[model samples]
Target: MLRFFFSFLFVQIFLCQTSIAQTDWSKQLDHYISKRDEIDAVKKKTIKNLLKDLQSTREEKNRDKEFIALMQSVKAYEYFVYDSAFKYAQSANRLAYQLNDKSKIAESKSKLSLIMLLKGLYTSSIDTLNTVEYQYLSNEKRKEFYSTAYRAYYDLSGYSRDKHYSEAYKKLGHFYSQKLIDEFKEPSFEKLLGLALQSMVTGKLNQAEDYYIELLNQFNLNNHETAIVTSGLGFIYSDKGEVEKAKEYLMQASIADIKSSTKETTACRSLAEIFYKEVEIEKAYQYILLAKADADFYGSEQRKFEISYILPLIESARFRKENKQKKMFGLIGVLVLVFSLVILRQLQKLRQARKEIVRSNQNLIHVNEMLREASQIKEEYIGYYFNFSSQYIDKLEDFKKSISRQLITKSYDNIEQELKKYNSKKERQRLFEDFDRIFLKLFPDFVQRFNQLFDEKDRIRLKDELSLNTDLRIFALIRIGVNDSEKIAGILNLSVNTIYTYKTKIRNRSIYPNEEFDLKVMAIKSV
Candidate 1:
């Protein structure tokens, strides 16, 4: 049966069997609301509303498989956050791949790369964007891909710490000359926002203002787009030294931007930055602090850096002086150093002792692991023995009974004793293959789930090459409490070498390449 996925026409929707199911968005919303006292902030509040919107549409016209997968992608992205935006982006990228939607793949990868740049992972961001750069697609789809890539590269260059801004400038130029205008001709709320931000980055204040104004007219009065566009325009004006005009727009932008759960952080941050320039110190500090807290919560490296660049200026000089004075306490310092040295010597001795104890513990642990594996193997062996013995014993008992009944022969009493021995053997033999069926059933899914970590290219390269072969499988099983590699080998009908080969292949596929098999095992331990 061909299963249909009914995911209401999200960009880059794809059909696949292993579609992820969307959770009840309302349930999540209520869950957070129930915990409302514990959750407070513009960003979090926005997340809440985003959840509501997604849920609201669940009962709408298009409820299908594709939509569910997209929801899962969104949920997962929100759930597992990091200091870098790249991680969420990567997950979304994988979600796209699973769906077989090329547009989604590009969007996810591009967004992740963009976040990475904001988080100071410039090289990695650039590498990711380049690796997934789109070359063959429809005109609209192609524009989406390059536009994302353009922003990613541009942001990456700006955060590079190195002085080469040429890459960023060039990408910015390309975005302005091509992607921005093209997207504007047929604006998506999401893409429109990006273009507005891009306009500002390229220093095209007039163009930015134009885009913002156009967006304002296009968006519904109270929507996320209105506030985002308004705030963006305010920033542009502020950048060009038009403080009064900037403040006016931002103050107005705040109403829509702050109200919508989708765009409060950027709105708040922009407002804060403008207020600071106006030297509304207390008010400025309040908004900046709000922005800082929001950024930290979301792991927004971009926001963190924005705060960091200006932190020293506003820092209390009195605290600095006090710290300097404390550092100059020479007598106290010498006394502390002496104590520290003594503690260090003691710690070193303690560490050496601990190492000895750990070594002993490790040996004991290894023995225990071996025992557990042996136990499982013993079970399997018993099962096999009982399976064969039960049939054999039954046949033997029947033979004796048949002979006695036919001939009225002597030693009929001995038949019962022989039957008892056979029964005992059968009972012992019944234990093997107890888990074999179950284990085999779970193995396929295990492969799929673990492989899900990689993108299509990674999976294809790894799978076709038989990269995560037997050795890695052995250890992986061990990691999950399957200790008997020999039993595993028996099940696989191959020697231990086959298992070792699998390990080598998996390690080679890793970001850190390893040639030493022993070291690879040690590394897997850490991973």
Candidate 2:
């Protein structure tokens, strides 16, 4: 059914082109409104009286009165509202049929067909035109019949793309266009409009511009003529690549359409496409929506399809913009989370380190107290040992004096007996015993502590528990910061070679290396 409709439309277009010139006046919607407003203002009084007379005639219910009223109504609304115009035209047809007025029927049907074409129902327009019997039409009505047919085909040609149909429609439109020209003898507004359309359809843009501009200058164009002229200029400037001028003219046409209450227009759609191509997205979207609303209101399927192409492109661009923003926000959120985690982990580690430092400070404070007590003990022991040594020296001095007096008295037996009683080994033994007692008092657990540094087999076992062995005495001297081997040997009453041998043997048996043995021994706990 759709194919048949389009095919019929194309055929009518071809036929109409064979007899007329095709002009796309839809572009000049603004020019039409500007012209229509002027015409309506001038005809306002006449239209008002006609409407009053029609209402009275309707109330009277007389055949002649009714017939005249219906015709008047059709004529009055022809430029105001197409649907109202069509409705009145149909009323005229019905009245003429009842009155058996064939001429009136033909005129009414012709008017109806033209309105149908304006509504974009090409097949219906052609069918309406076919219903009008040509023989019954008046000479003026016959001319109107051809003129309306020419307009219908002209409009159809604009929407058709088939090369064969396009060419045929163009030729037919030119033929009828010339015939219409023959009907005009002078340079009137209608003639001028027809001439401009003819020139434009034939691609003679300069001629069309001259005619249209001349018409606009000379006469106040009606809504339809203004639409035709301005839209033609817009097309011409667009072809010349004068984008601003073209847009200006198209905008003017659109404004005219708005003021004139004309919904069937191409200017808004054209402007939308231009803005879209120029990447003016917001303007494109605004214009496209307007165009779509107008197209839907106008009820033209072709215009609806044309608008459909641009809507999706703009919507997709909007969606992509929104989607990109969402992704960017998501990435920012992820980055913030990762950064927060990094700071949290650093804070945790810092807290743990602070705890460890506080614990270490507490342990250091306890160790410092132990060292202070040990220092005081060492000082008191040293003072006691020095006092005891001083008293023992005084007693030895008195004993020496007694022995000397006995020897001088010439008693060889007494001197020999005193000398035998005071043996050198026995005196040395008493001195060592006193030293051990003072040393042991200072460090009671010295033997146990010293032996802990070596393996069981390498440990020094003293036969006398009261006295330290040679090696123990050497390290003990080292623990007291007395590391000199000669000083140690003199204090222990041993040879320097024996002291050295004892030091080397103990060091070899120690868990610590040779070089670090003395340091390790010094590091032993004082208590």
Candidate 3:
């Protein structure tokens, strides 16, 4: 009887352990199921933690590698909270690649690219995506990659102020837009859209509407699509200064029953902009309230803050308008009171409104002036800086030997001592400016040539500087036309490697497979 009890106890112990293991496995699977709900933030988090625990178990069992990748995706989705999500996603992506699980890898890559994009790391995003695009397996995946690349290019173009990059992004956007539209058995509709959007972005406003109308027709099939197309058209009309047409599309967009908070918020904002521009104050205010409601639903801090900043300004403008109207009404009661007193009061109030209007008009004028001044200043600086630099750089060799002789046994400290002899700040400033003008005129191509001498990264850093190192600037002058590196270096009071290093950095920054990207030629010549 005792031996029988012992056997039963052993069997019970073994069964309990097996049951616990099975329960844990089931719980992990449940976590993944919830995580698959892309919109559920809480589920995303729960899945992510569960995934970390599952990783060790997966390795121990030497099984379910795809499951491990799914967990990695769950963690990556939560990257909006922690920056490490990018790193974790990358690791999982590499593992997926090793496992030949291309699908999960693509998902991981897309997620990673988006994270980089949101963080404003456009260059890194582009670089990361370049590798991932090759792994795209489906048309959907290819469409996604192209879209991401297009957006990344747009962001990069904005930062660099490069029109070439902007055009490239526009082209890519059209490509992806076409891909998405074509996949729906509406090739003409998509083609129309491509032309419209491309034209709108490129400022060909006259041709955009027909496509917008066609896109709007799709709204019958998908009301949400209709809303988006109309809203886009409204904005385009707004850009063209056609306030009435803009309002029509904006109102249409606002009427859509959208589950997407972002879509609803955008439509509301569009409506508000139209109302504001049309001077429909009450309608504008109402639209803003509606926009706020949608913005709150979306949980986007950027949208909330943008609205917050605009709200007070909007309210103040409305208040002033209302009070000004009341003051106008007050003027009508002029005949009832004692004439002089009434006249005085009217004058005071009229004076106040006029003052307010004047102040507002003055502010507008000031803002316009500032804008004009800023534009003029920028154009003048770029034109003069580059043009003058080219001219000065041309004459670098004329004074290179003279400057080099003076500098052979000298130091920067000695130059500063000479600068100190100028007794007044004004004199010093004048002297510095004069020297700059002369030095730059002599080596006008110095900045470009100097930049040409750097690696790509260094060139980017240097191109941003309005002025460069004096000695290097001098060397750039010598290098502009003088091909001998050693002669140029000694003439500019620099070592041979200093000249060589400059040349090397410039080469690195240049378009690949080419060297001696002549700074003088590039700076002075236009393509």
Candidate 4:
């Protein structure tokens, strides 16, 4: 009975030990699964070459050895492609079974369980792991099995709505998580990856980010490992609401996944959703398209479902925005055209106003010239009138003195002769000569300018240079304001009828109107 009790205690301790070494399998797998598309081209080539070498080998032992190497190669693609990984793992399992190798069998089963878990078949993954007997597994194989089992239960707990089953799975997953930590005897890349993922699962984002940063900086990581670290950083920053930083890390992870030929990266899709929310439609379309292609290539139902929800929304928004911009531009073009026409109309009006201003200025200049000419004519006439009046007054005074002298001396006959000299025809002739000289002095070009108004045949010519013709005398008198026909006839010792006839002839010969002829004559001035 004591032996039975000790055996039971030992079994309990062994069971506890197994639980302690198990990890959060879902998160560990997800870290690499999100970068499944990112596979190194060179490594793929090398694996193909190894497979070619395996096919060419004739010996069974050589084929088995190559199969082991091929298994390692296919393990690289396990998280990337479920069916391909399953096939390779099955081949490796068969090869190990033929060799009676328990360690190799356990390793292949652990790998198969990981693929099953990635497909989200948690119960199937746990069942596959249970088929491997833990007591016979190598340390590494045992750790892998426990890791796969823990991830399966953790996922089950997360999806469970029932409180009792959820709590039970959670407690089981926690025990496996602690075991995964305790089992790592030394620091390693795998250990760091497990720690980072476990932190993320527990909502310890800060610790997760720190662990991922360390993995990136201190270690020479594989393409898959690099993608995992970068993607985790993106998730942490995204949760913290640092969108720009999150996008940067997510883009890096996405690129690495593509380069490494990873089959399942959600970083691109996450960025697409974020850009859509921010109204960056074009960016959303670009990222979502790449994600859609990836999901199509992956042939994964979950990825297809997630992308379906947001793709149409972003595309519709982009179309609406483009149409709105086109209409807005059309309106702006119409407004600009209308504004241009208005400006042209205003310019034309301004030019017309300027032309009118120029014409008005020209009219004002012509009026000013006419006023100046009139002012000059008045000044010349004023001097001439005063001199002529003074000479006439002196002649009258001399005549009066001569008549009185003749009366005092009793020379009636002499007085008569003297009076004739002073006031008769000869005296009138002298007075006319005096008037002509004064008028000619005042208006030297008067005859020539006046003749310019008439036809060549009608122009007046004087008989003597010192005397005026009847017609010349009439117009010359009019020029100096002796305008009345009677006054002009008396001054020139002619009849009013003759004077009227002469004035009529001059007016008829003039270029101007009959009424304006006299005025034009008066307007004439000295050269």
Candidate 5:
């Protein structure tokens, strides 16, 4: 009886201790979850303290103290803010080099490699890792080196996705990960994580799941660790086609990441992909945009690349769905509107008949006014044409009389001079001047309105109001409805090519585009 009681007590104590341990982790998780919204503020406060310490250490001019300060700042910023983390890591590296400390240099470079990996600089991360001398690194530094190298290769393998290169990258990743695992004792977080990742890479989903579950059970993880573990479970479930379970784990991981202010993460992106495949477009779009924002904030090119494929697909699907809904609503509205209009039409049949008679009378009156205005314009132009013809006839008669007098006197020089005075070029110039004057009289604001189409520097300025330049003349023809290049060229006594050239050059110089310029010219009101 005594032995049995002792055994029962021992069992009870062990169970209680186990329950307390699990409860502790649960409380920590709850605490972070509650403070998710305040994570950024908390991070800022922590960084502020770190900077204060850094400044004090810098003022002391002790290289070792400053180095430690910079490394602390780097660690503080690594998961939340990569740019600052990278800057501090770089400063630490330069200081290490300056101090001629091989161990510090190796440690700093390893930290830099991890930051580079976070920043999607995979090749640079690998290159940076290669520069570190393993012999000079302490055990802890070696662990970091192996871890960075492992992640760099693993991520590079996935990013490539090409069978040829991916296989080689995967092998290197396995090599480094195994090295990392060996650096740790058994049942450690680092060892378990490495084993889980290896199982995942090797296509042992069940084994990977077991490893992750063991990690969760054996450890009271912080926010970062929780994010990592949950994210792994999310991927495993996703691969196993357990969509609901995948989403649950991914959501928890994403929430934890947010609580920790971890911008460099895959949780949000994984959630987006799963939602996208589930055809929950709104959820997918929201998560993808969130993922993109985090990637942009983290400055991770790899994350951006991963998102690029899904984001556009989600946006397009969303647009198509919205357009479909809009079209359906529009069809329904049209049907209702048509039904209403038909009812209204039946009730107002007699009233509409009366309105039609009144509307016809109004349209007839408007047409009469337009015809009267057209007749008046015709009369003015015709009267002006007859008077101009009479004046030209008189001038011709005068020219004939002068020529006859020259011939009778046998003054060949005077005849030659008279012929030269009546040359085609001079006659054409006079004709153009007359046309310009008459056109301007008919539309007084044509030049002013045409100038408005161009910028101040490009506007055409006439030497005199009585004449137009070639460009202005071409547009003037267009304003008068002589839009065809051949017709305008015939009127201006120019080749069709020259007319087209002038039109193109003027339109190119205008503030309006080519297609709109002609329309704008035609829009000019006629007096």
Candidate 6:
């Protein structure tokens, strides 16, 4: 019973270990997908450094070092750039031939075959593979040779689309896949990949998924490995009708392929077909275009031919969707245009209303200014009138008293002399002085400002600061809005003809044009 318990414990332990080995790495896969661009950049920088090392090895003139460098360059560029990888592989093959190294020749030919397969030259790839001597290749090179041969036959089978030829090609592919699996003594990435591919081809989807998942868990995969494993899972899920899981895996695979700069990939094309079936036209069109671009970049004629079949269907659907959206947008645009015109018209009306309000405010301000000026004039003239009237009354009373005294003394000559004592010219001169003082009091800067309108040489020079010249007085009245020549003539006690002559003479001497001179005068601000 104790021995039975030990055996049972051993079996349980072995199953537990197997289960642990197949643990899910979904989170790590997500992390790699998210950091695709960053990872791609690092890989590209590594390739750049490797290329520099290749140049240094060539310059050293060491054939062995040169061969190693060329092979390293081929490995570095294998996933990133197929053309460059092919060129390096060819160079390595030539160097190996020149060195007469059979092992190196077989390794270089295996690399060339893989690159040719990626480039859609399937027959050429198979021909190149046939030239490689399996006996001369090392264990690792033999595994690589079998892997490339399996992929070339598999791809050719798909490309042929003929029942007889496809079956024959598929049989050859299975043979190579079995050989690749036989190369490994234990589970490895390549071995597991080969097993998964074999199961997938033999319609053992459950077994294939198990193998791919185990590969994912067993290795810390680079971008290239991640893409291959995820792509296999995607195909398995798709075949099992688990569409959502298929899409998720395919998306991850596509991201991984992009990160590795692997352009010879079918993930995008598969995704395009899935999305197209779901009637997701935009996504289908987008992925189809990306597939076409990758095919073109990788120079894959087979991939291009495959894309050509589905591209037009997705493009037609997308064109119809776009036309429908354009019609809807056109209607919306017309509504927006009408709304804008209405808003613009309302804006114009608002501006006009604002302008009218501004003009009304200006008119009210002008009226208020006129009222203030009129009030000032009335107050000043009324005070002057009272003083003048009082003086005249006092002078008349004194004259009457003097005449009476002369008459009472019977002196007629003395009375006549008293009447003659009053000088009219002197009174008129005093009245003129009062008028000048009052006008100057109303507009203190009137003389200086009025002179500024004329040329410097023609400007009026005042005899005294308190008085204005004839020209100054004429426009000063106009500045106060007494625009009539007749009214100005009456106020200054001069003839209308004299007023006109003074106005014309000053205007002609002014710096401004005749038409604009009055407007400029009016533009002068008041205190």
The sequence of per-residue lDDT tens digits that candidate 5 reaches over residues 1-527 is: 99999999999998677556434543554566467558878888999999999999999999999999999999999987777888789789879988999989889988988998898767667877877887788777787688778778877888785699898998998998888776666556777787888888889999999999999999989988999999999999999998777777787787788888888889878887887887778877777887888788878767776776667677666656665665565566577885655544443664465456556546655665675586588558757878988998998999999999999999999999998887777877887887788778767788999999999999889989878888888888777645446778898998999987888788899999765676678668766
- Per-model lDDT: 0.52, 0.69, 0.56, 0.71, 0.80, 0.78
Q: Give per-residue CA lDDT, model 3, range 1-527, as digits (tens).
A: 99999999999998677556434533443343344235345534665676676676666755355446554553434323323455455555656666677776676677667666655556556656765643454654555555566556544544455677667766666665555565545444434555566666667777777778766665343545566577778788888887666766666665542322122236666666656665667766776776676556434434555466445455556666776775665666564455547656666776687577657756755665565575465456557657756765664554465456557867657555555643555643443454455445545555565555456566544432445554455444443334445666755556988887876665556654332244233234211
lDDT of 4 by residue, 371-431 (tens): 5586577567667768878987998899889889889999999988986675477767776
Candidate 3 yields a Cα-based lDDT of 0.56
TM-score of each: 0.44, 0.49, 0.43, 0.51, 0.57, 0.55
Q: Could you arrange the candidates by TM-score from highest to lowest?
A: 5, 6, 4, 2, 1, 3
Model 3 quality (TM-score): 0.43
lDDT accuracy of residue 372 in candidate 3: 54
lDDT of 1 by residue, 1-527 (tens): 12333343332354222222212322332354344334335445655675565556545734333344444444433312443233334444655666677666665665665555545555556666665546434566555456556666555555555566665555654653466466457665546656665667667889878878877788665445566566777778877887666666665554443344331145556766665565555445555665566567667655665665443332322233434544445445567886655555555665576566556646655665665575576456546657766876787788767667745655656656555555544433332233333333334344444444445565533342222444434654543333234655665566767765765566566544342322233223210
State residue 401's C-alpha deviation in candidate 5, in Å.
99
lDDT at 490 for candidate 4?
81
Global local distance difference test of model 2: 0.69
Best model number under lDDT: 5
Candidate closer to the true structure by lDDT (higher is better), 1 or 2? 2
Off by over 4 Å in 5: 1-37, 331-527
Runs of candidate 2 exceeding 4 Å displacement: 1-55, 62-85, 130-146, 318-527
lDDT of 1: 0.52
